[model samples]
Target: KTSLVVSYTTNGYPTEYIPTAFDNFSAVVSVDGKPVRLQLCDTAGQDEFDKLRPLCYTNTDIFLLCFSVVSPSSFQNVSEKWVPEIRCHCPKAPIILVGTQSDLREDVKVLIELDKCKEKPVSEEAAKLCAEEVKAASYIECSALTQKNLKEVFDAAIVAGIQYSDTQQQPKKSKSRTPDKMKNLSKSWWKKYCCFV
Candidate 1:
């Protein structure tokens, strides 16, 4: 099972101050004593996504969609566009919603002013709503720097993948034979006949 972390951006430019965000995304999960492969990409909006959609469609089992809780716009972009596009390409893929920089709330506030020249407050309620709308299998508030809640994120993803894999392996049941068929196939035919006699 392959895992991909998807993030969207306007143009090919990385969302202004997300370099640290990338660095902190080092969450790890192991399957059957083997480490799972993880991929990170910036969809770069519709144009870039169009080019990458085919690749994702053919590959990828789980997607961890991350956005900053501080930036409502980023959350909106993923909710309105990225999530749907990824779902369309990989319908069966399990998705985990992650809110990054849980330890850097102070830094997030500073960056918001520096990058956008405006102050926007982070809202936990809004993040929860976004997570719900996207049908996120699990939601994690994490910090890549401190590694807080990072393990939980990967753990949840791995559990979800395993559960999904197990579900797919379950054998399908066929329709049961009718009463007449059961009677004919009974193992105690001689006993029934002797009893009757």
Candidate 2:
């Protein structure tokens, strides 16, 4: 998860593994020719931070529920742990299931290590199936190291966030305003939309 966030924000992989409690990044991206500010929160998934993680989910518009494709245990944790926790806190937020580390899924060294433990990389089909089971908005596989499908993951997240925000605000719209006026999103949009992963 740290690798994904660091690579996306910095355009380079970290030299070493540094445990993070929680970190956030902001980026200005163009979606449909409009500037959108995205606040991405990289929350810790370790058991130690379990008590503190939910504090960040309160106002989240979308979630990127990520698991490593090369690690079966991490994939298991997606369903066994992360999804339930996110749902408990932000039931209405959209979730995009992400399979990270796609570049290492076929690495010889990693495969050998996994073979020793009688495990294999999580297949794309299984991840998609899990996404359906958990009612995720979408499923995407990406490699932070090689930067494959990295942009697509965030792009999908942005679209999902905007769509979810639209749904939440639909009921509050005045009858005088037509549906076409919805495109006039507030300039202070960053204050309302935050994505967690």
Candidate 3:
């Protein structure tokens, strides 16, 4: 089973602009199958995140904490608050940090500067540091608009989640599939032919 939780914040705060939205987070249970569960949570700030916690804890194999690369505040919120909150409940879950909206860096920079003047600066470097501190399995930049690195981000997250799961799984008994198995068979002409073959 696989699952995902995505959150976003738009506008800013106090003034209350429209909350940012998210594309569906999807997963395939098999190699050539449609996703069993593709959930989207389009909400603002901590409220949406709080609503997502239970779903994440219950269903998700990987938690992708995504923030707009353009919006420093979004990254800051994840690193400083959201990630910790999620960890408290799902500490073992693998986290994949996604820096979204990479295509809108210029516009985002302007917004960031404005926020900075208003004493609400967003720092990309700071966000990266925070991701490192929290031991993110991977960090990637993506753009939903252009679909840049979208697959890469999710693929990395899935890979990290699978690796983490494999590490946690109990070792199973080894199944013999070697010369020993062949030797255990009857030493008939057929067996010899099979062995040589």
Candidate 4:
């Protein structure tokens, strides 16, 4: 997620692995002389953050449910972990199923490693099928390293967020919670990370 936002906003790929626990980035682009803002929320996918992550979903307009194409476990999590979680929190929000790291699908070293594990790269057809099962609005495969289909991912996010906002429920003020788990969460949290272009 950080890579996606950083690549688009900075036009540079991170040289090393630097995980983000949580961060929000904002970008404003002038479209036809009108300024449009986009927010990209980078949330940790670790199991420890599962409870805290829902706090970011209260008013989410759309979800980009992403999984690495070369990781079978990640792909499995799309249906087993992600789709269910998002449905519970944002039932009406649109979802765009994303297969990340398409560039690695053909890497010999990666393929050999996966072969040892008796696994293969996820096929586009299978990804699309999963999208249908989850009722996702769209499915796209992209490689941030190569910038392949990267712009389409964000473009789809903007379009779907805008369209969903028109028909979806107004952002309901989430009930104030006082638990320590909720202490660091900001109101309008989703807005801090994402906006329609």
- Per-residue accuracy of model 3 over 45-135 as CA lDDT, tens digit each: 4465566535535434567777766665666677677677767767877777777766666576666676676733335676667678888
Off by over 4 Å in 1: 1-49, 108-119, 169-197
What is the Cα-based TM-score of model 3?
0.59
Relative to the unseen true structure, what is the C-alpha lDDT of residue 149 in candidate 4, on a scale of 0 to 100? Answer: 92
* Decoy 1 TM-score against native: 0.61
lDDT per prediction? 0.53, 0.85, 0.51, 0.76
What are the per-residue Cα lDDT tens digits for candidate 1 across 1-197? 01113121111223234322112132233566755533333333345346644453343445667777566666776677768877777677677787776565667555667467564545667777777888878777876555567667666766665565445434465356667755754422211000000
lDDT for each residue of candidate 4 in 132-195, tens digit (9 for 90 to 100): 9999999999888888998898778777876776555343454645565354443222232352
lDDT of 3 at 64: 71
Q: Which residue runs of candidate 3 sit more than 4 Å off their true CA positions? A: 1-25, 29-52, 108-124, 171-197
- List TM-score per model, in order: 0.61, 0.90, 0.59, 0.84
For model 2, where is the 10-residue window of minimal lDDT?
A: 185-194
lDDT of 2 by residue, 56-96 (tens): 89768889999999989998988899899988988889999
Sort every candidate by TM-score, greatest first.
2, 4, 1, 3
